[model samples]
Target: MKKQVLSYWLKDSQKKTYPRLEKNLNVDILIVGGGITGILCAYQLAKQNKYRIALVEKNRLYHSTTGFTTGKVTVQHDDIYHQLIKNKGETIARAYYQANSEAVQGLKKIVEEENIDCDWVDTKAILYAFSEEEAKRLQREQNAYDTLGIPYEWLDKETLPFQTLGGLAIPDQGVFHIVRFLDGILNNLNVDIYEKTKIIKTNPTEKGAVAETADHYKISAKHIVLATHYPIYKRFNFYFTKIKPTCSYVAIAHEFAIKPENAYINLIDPVLSIRFLDSADPKLMVAGFGHDVKNYYSYLDQIHKLKAMATERLGAKDFTEEWYNQDYESMDMVPLIGKITDAPLYLATGFRKWGITSAFVASLIIKDLIEGINNQYAYLYDPNRNKNTFKTVCYNFAMLSTVIKTKLLTVPKSIKINPGNGRIIQHKGSKIGLYIDQNGKTYSVKPICTHLGCTLRFNNVTKTYECPCHGSRFNYDGTSLDGPAVRNLTQL
Candidate 1:
């Protein structure tokens, strides 16, 4: 069998192209980033028949987390309601529940209204636990559901091959081809889209704001939304301190005997989330064994355990596709949406691997905020909510520890790097990241993050240099692949 190290969704789909921004333009609303949040924000705003909106993406659509997501359209995000209620207030937690639930309906309604050809499948979203401790936690979450008036059913049994204590089930959840759904929306959206247009920086003006592209083209708008998953702006909102980024992996198994009627994720560490694709080709997708982005290739072997799990439980015989994706989560788990520091500039992020409904929720909130309408969930998802300062301080301290450890360890070490492999070495008192390709071509780059000067770690599997502090990633040739790091590594 053939093997692909790309997302099965990306590997199997047709890509749509948009023109890059070549000159300065002015619009009423300028949306930065083209992930689901940005696209959906544009979609919602366009529906009002107001605002001259232009959506700019650094790369083509579906080339980011929007394409690599697990693609489940459910409101169940692990077992988060209980935590939300505890950390945030009941009002915020309840609002989050209602927003996400409504988002699911909104997505389904769009599919029905547009008669989109995306493979939509309705299924129960279930959460199973193997330990008694986890089962008790599920009961507590069930209590939270009761308090919030959310409907759920008790799951006394599990269909999986492993022994489970008990689980909870939420009905009316669904799954679909996320890319196809977006494509369907894009076909009808009356918005200008520019791919490969990187907005390097944004400056505040008295009237509104102006965003400068990497090519020195400016887009002046009354409002600019930084829907980039990780806020590319380094210092403005200070999101880097609260947000945590991770590198997660997924594998698809074909011809699997186990077919589930619902989406399932366990209450366990190194979480195991399972879903299916039912269409011309039926397959099982197992995801969620990840580490901090800084760990990179060090913890990549965890995905192998997830594969062995599918092989054991589902009788998965053919594993053809495996890939890695990045996710950003807030320390408090609730997503961040709305204006950045009360400016016309906005952001929606910290989806925590549940971007489907969260993105819709963001679009709704952002649209309302822009229209000057008070959305019920607006304050709950606001990016400006003042919370614990200790969490921020602790996060930054850990970041500082990473910096110290990296710099102290970067002494001169003579090493022989083989072809098809890479290593960091001290060259004239400066750390240099070196990667040798299969053909013996060498690629050299400064081993430092452009965002915060953090030491960059190399991922052998994905062939990218990743930053732990802010989750910036670069390709082997020193090209920026992901952000909070908008700048590429320096060639050395």
Candidate 2:
């Protein structure tokens, strides 16, 4: 209830809670984080009658990124097929499409078997180009699609409501109430799930692994899965350096009239992704472009701009709900899945905005690993792959440069802030942060990020402090609201 943004999907849903792990427990498999991947992984492993799987969440289940999504269950991730071919390889790119395409149908089978009422639909997914340059990019993407034998329909300028160039649409895609879909699956699971159970540390053991909670409770398991968006373990995989945290916003309009219903995305920086809802509460959802978390902006401005775009182009009515979600993106623009450590520990992160397919694929692959079976797609998503791409080196160097650049910045001797406002000010020989609430109450904390010591930035619209480097978030009172920062800002 204290959240700054209310997602359209979560607005009318009843909050579900699971018991917390209060004492040390042992299980055949320990799953940390209760997002879709973790829940689905538990569902798969639990139903297999193999591992005595138990899932734990640091906070409420399904309240994080999973709750705030465009809910498009499709294999089309921008023109990633073409990009992946250029960066990774043709084989990897083909595997990427093949794996996700299978996951899409795999999800359909689950929904049908369980008869889950998540407003499932088999619609079309579109990728539009906004400029001539983007059209050329789309052409290349089409070539890649040909190589992969992925069928698609091409669109001209007149086919769309408003567009600069053309687009491509893939049939057999879907849209659903993802939160409801996840809830439907979770409510029927036989496995034990614990909420508000934060795992702060994990150690590889002779037998398996031991994960310790912030409260010092432990869960010893024969295997552990880090399905959290960004694995909290900083030592292994160098996730903080390899995975770049990006955030994006979304706005919903309950009244809309659009033709040829399909999930759409445009080729633009911070692409504007749009999807429609034909359910009882018919609406249109438009997501603002994603930007690196380190790049701070006026969050309110983003919402305003998104609404304006929807109103002008899509003929959207009054907006009902809007929120933001942060997703991790690896340097190579591919998800990092499977075992990252020598121990029987697996992680799936850097999903970008296409978590639906990625999450399902993750569950399938992790299940295969648990069963000691070889999954062909495992090599494509391997987290330990040599990611020394030019982009990776450049990105990590830029992040480190940000640390050095911020550390040397000169601070003012004194500063003043208005009520209900937050600002970084020089305090006690160090630049700290201070927030003055509307009630004229003051809250102060150190501005250094606990995850990597990067300087923190204030998101005025959300009234929370965020790390520019890795997306750690804290309340004005200095309690950590997001991770991979388990520790809150030091209260000053």
Candidate 3:
């Protein structure tokens, strides 16, 4: 039997591909990503018809992070309120909760008004604990919720398949089919959409910015939005240093015996998120086991661990679909959603795996910033907010350490690399990435990241060269897959 590699969401829904940019055209705003954040921003701006809006996507719409998400639309982000209250303040913490809660309500209103049947379901979001330490953290989160005047329920017993010490439940949180929801909005909007349109670079003009595509087509717009998962431009913002990329695995199993009443996440080390999709046949999606992308020895091993957990603990006979998702977490924990250093180029990223609500919040903030409307939550997610120097210093140190390790590590001299496998080895006094196909054809490239010159490591499961410094990924043939890295690895 063939392995299921795509997400259940993508498998069940019909995906619409758009035309690529064949000619250079000017627009008032040019959004450079087609994920939920970019699409929603385009939808909001295009609905007004005040300006000509164009969205350009490097790949299919919603095929990236948005499509791979577990589709939980909740504000409860893994015992975050307690830390927010402690680190930032009660006011900021309350504002964070309020922003996300408002985003949920806003999305709900849109679904209802538009009659979007994206399997929208309103349910409580529960954060449970398995250990005493986690339980205490949950208590602190509950206290923070109370101080913020947010309504929640403290539960000792729940309908979850497994046992938990206790949990905090925030009502009215939601889960939905992300692609379908975005499709509903996209269908109703008038924005010019382009797919397979890779923006190679963006140059700031006196009036606005000019985005140059890989095909040499130039799009001049009054404003630009870098809604790509990772900001392609690195010089101005230094998002590569600020945001740390982590990859998580998810598996979906059909006919789950024990379905919880609400969306669930745990407070354990390897956090597990649970949600159910009620379509023609019910399916349970389990997501967790996140780690730094470079730290994993093998992506297949990580997937095996996730699969074992699901099969043993959740009574899943087998997974109908399985895939991995990547997310960037900011050093300060808050998402960076605003202008990139007073430039007309705006950015929205570092959602830390909780992008469903963060993306909506980002769309609102970016829309307001562009239209000169005052959004109160803008300050909380500013890209150039006051730096937590200690955290920033630590993050930079870690990145530097990874770079040093990658550069200094000795490569194997005469290792036999098997087919369907990849490795970095020393060749001609320099590191080279080598991969052999099942048919015994060999491909090699310089094992250096195109983003920042960090040494690249081979990801055995995905068969890609991944950067340890900033999570840029490249195909075995040296084509760029994900960024921070815009350029492909140098072919040897």
**All candidates in order of TM-score, best leading:** 1, 3, 2
Error of 3 at 351 (Å): 0.3
| Per-prediction CA RMSD (Å) | 2.0, 2.5, 2.0
lDDT, ranked from best to worst: 3, 2, 1
Residues 1-492, model 2: lDDT tens digits: 232368777764557778888999999999998888898899889889866888999888877778888889999998899998887788989999999999899898888988888888898898888777888989999999998899999988798777458789899999988877888898789888999888988888999999998889999999999987778765654677788888888988866657537788987775678888756667788997678876656688777887787777778777877788788888887889998657889999889888989999999899999889999999888998765777778888888877776677666667778998888877768888889999999999998888878888777667888887778888888877676888879998
Task: Give each model's clash number.
Answer: 0, 2, 0
TM-score of 3: 0.94
* Candidate 1 TM-score versus the reference: 0.95
Candidate 1 residue 187 Cα shift, in angstroms, is 1.7
> Which 10-residue window in model 3 sums to the lowest lDDT?
252-261
Better of 1 and 2 by TM-score: 1
Model 1 residue 348 CA deviation (Å) reads 0.5
TM-score of each: 0.95, 0.94, 0.94
Residue 127 in model 1: lDDT:
86
Query: How well does model 3 score by local distance difference test?
Result: 0.85
